[model samples]
Target: MKAAQCSDYTSTNTYESVLTVQESVPTPNLEYDTPPAGFKNPMLVRVLSVALAPGDVRVMTGDTRELQGPPSMPYTPGGDVCGVVVEMPKESKKKGGWSFGVGDRIAARFVNKPMGMLGEYALVSPDVCDKVPESISNDAAAALVSSAAVAVIISDYIKEGDRVLIYGAGGGVGSHLCQAVRLKGASYVVGVGKDAKRLKSKPISCDESVNYTKDDAFNNKEWQDKPFDVVVDLVGGIWPKLVDQNQSEKSIVKSANQGGRYLTTTPDSAIFQGRSVWQILRVFLFPALWRATYTRIGFSRSYRPQYSYVIGLPSTSDIVTRTLSLAEEGKLIPCIDDSGPFPFTTEGVRDAFRLQASRHAKGKIIIKVSEK
Candidate 1:
């Protein structure tokens, strides 16, 4: 099985190296074919999976590492998969790591531990699988992981008609949130970040978009005194406070409802490091705190209120699923930064990551795992 192993498994620095497809001893003579239904277990099928940590910046790892591929050492950093199930687990019919027997078209959310999905075929856990909705294309589904899931998680915490402001609103998660907000009936979904071309490529629900490069960006004249109902901040570090003075009750919030985090359920590396212990703790403890705060403000004398909240929780797939349905209905469209000839060859996976590493890339980048 081919996989991208993290060399920095215990290091603060994050670097992954690709080893040769590990050929196991007493290897089962796995045949080459498709799974009976839509899952491929114990069989070889062409697949493409996204490796780990390819972006302008790494979350939790702190500081951005150059997005460069290793020279034939650490392979692909992929663990998330959108691919074909060429075989089914031999253990049981109801409980294979796939939906189909063989030759099935499917998409899966992998538990990044135990294995990865960066090559032709990977041994994986079937319990985490979700049938790719017919409405979702493979590229879109592939793009749906990671950033899309983050957006879905963040948007779930907001109230309908709430004015929302999003930082890091141009990359994958930001783009997904920008689109996902429409389903929530957001009063105003304002998106902020870089990649000017991507910002304009699709008509997102964000009522306005401001480039962080031009002038003070979020602090420009257009937003001198505007207060937000909710703030989903992905752009970290320096922040200049902005709130409506008249409201008196500051409602500027980020996913800080849980200390600037919405991804509490996903056990990514940050969680393992204990670096985000407080962050995750907030996800668990914030809801109660929020309920109390809301009630106190509602009945208190000091509750004049501008608008805003820090929302951070695991969003049910409802929003992403709904958006996908909307796409199917032609009511919404995902900006197609790039689509493909379906499953890519191993070399193609390498090239795709190389392109994805370029800081200018936009939209959901995908390597097809099979013919969809």
Candidate 2:
């Protein structure tokens, strides 16, 4: 089987040395990867398209391994996959409690394991697999699964008529999140990013857009006057830079409604690229810091708002299903960047990672793994 493999980790030129296409890698055995617990069903899928994510870039650069353990060797590093089901045992489907059959076009978010979708084939568990509708393109289907899953999960926190502010709202995940919140009946959806043009590129219906590079955008009187009820921050730790320097703290306090909910997906120093040992330590320590007694007590007393770090779980089959349905209905327009799909090659895969590492893509970066 020909596939791209992350054979080693690099400190400097991460993707250049870490990933390469190999011609003779053995195909995955569907029966071998399935668990003895009988909870996960295995589906051998002929890969069609796979999407690049920030997590894939982090994995390539070895940032995650320093804090967590290293990944298995010769790994394929992708999360979201759109593919055709080539084989699935009846017992596997029964055990996993899914009704899809062979040859069905499906999309899935695989668990954070060595096996990935950036290959000729991938073994997907049923819990993460959702049938992609005929109306959705392979690229869109591949791109939407993971981001839409996160949006669906986070939408649980949203309320009717809440004014929502999404940081990094111009990016792939943030754009879908904007739609999800809007569909939930947000009174206003304001997006904050460095590029106002990219932020407004898609008609995702963000009522207001902010370019943080502009002077004092966050604390600008317009935003301060219309305080938000929920803040969904996809960009972490950099929010302070977007606020007014003098009243950064007070402005954030004033901007949210009483008991406002603040959610961020990137809580670790991975967002910072883990440049130094201190940053690596921060990656491991951030979660602990959030749980600290004094930190918790102070936030509870002073802010009176709920702050949560969100992680998307692949086991949310219901969310995945609903997201696919929304995509088919044309309600969720995925913001795939202007740089369209990447061909399934060593160069394409490498370039995909570079685009992901840039942190400025307006939409999802997709790899066309196999021609349909």
Candidate 3:
């Protein structure tokens, strides 16, 4: 089997230096029988397409080592996968009414160690895998596994007829979040990002687009005339500053109506990079503590919107099923970065990671691992 393997973390070097395509890597070995009490056997999957995300970059560059520990050397680097089941354990027939079989197209969040779906074949647990509908393409299915799941989870916060604002609204999760909120009955959606054209385009189709690169990015009169009922911050570092006493009336916080919810996916840092233990703790803990105290004590009512962090919980079968169902229903469309579906190669993978790390990708960065 061929696989793209990372020899070491890219902390001290470029991604090109550490990541390479090896022609002869061993395929994952699977147990035919379930012998363990708590463990379920993993199914072997033939990789079709994989998506790159900020978390993948975090792990590759050793930014998350302190929190997630180190990845073993020469490891594959993708978690969002769309693949076909090539092998299944005998116990699968008797377990949890398993419906997947060999050759069934599946999309999964493959988080097992060392071996990942970047290779020709990888092991996937049925728990995190869901059948990809015939209507969904492999690329879209791969992209949906992670970002759309987060968007689906976040959509639960939206209420009918609410006016919503989203930062980084052109990125993978952001694009999906926009559609999800619309599906949830938000009266209006505003997407903020560097690329206004993409943010205003189809699939995302934000009611209004604000380009943060401009000098008067957040100064739109519409924001003040009709304040947002909910603010989803995919870009971090804005919420803490918004709540500061030194903030002026022109602050982004002022654009949201008092008592509106401010939800964030990245509370600690917007950019993933190597950080010291103290840095990580202070960034996450301080804001979290302040949010809790401020809301509980009623300080948030007068000063700012209610704050809450959006933790990317482990993918569940229900979430995956809902995401696919939404996709099948055309309510949620996976937005692939315009620059990708990069070819499966050494350079292609590196370029995909480069685009993802740039934080400017219009949507999900996908690497086409194999043809369907």
Candidate 1 residue lDDT tens string, 1-372: 433333332122322232222322122224543221223443333354442223312321322122122222232345446666665565553432333446654445434221345555655435544446677676665666545655665666666777767766775667777777766677777777765555545556457776777734444444434556555655542222332332443334432332222222222121222236465445434543553355344442132232223343222233334444555666545543453322344455445545444433455556555454
lDDT of 2 by residue, 185-261 (tens): 88888888767765665656677788877844456676566556777778776433423332444444232326566
Off-target runs (Cα >4 Å) in candidate 1 are 1-76, 91-101, 112-115, 201-205, 221-224, 238-327, 335-360, 369-372
Per model, state how many residue pairs clash: 37, 0, 0
lDDT of 1: 0.47
What TM-score would each prediction reach against the true structure?
A: 0.62, 0.85, 0.90
Top-lDDT structure, candidate number: 3
Tens-digit lDDT track of model 3 for 269-296: 7755436767776767677778856764
**How high is the CA lDDT of each candidate model?**
0.47, 0.71, 0.78
User: How much does candidate 2 score in TM-score?
Assistant: 0.85
Best by TM-score: 3
Record all residue pairs in model 3 with backbone atoms less than 3 Å apart, i.e. clashing. Answer: none
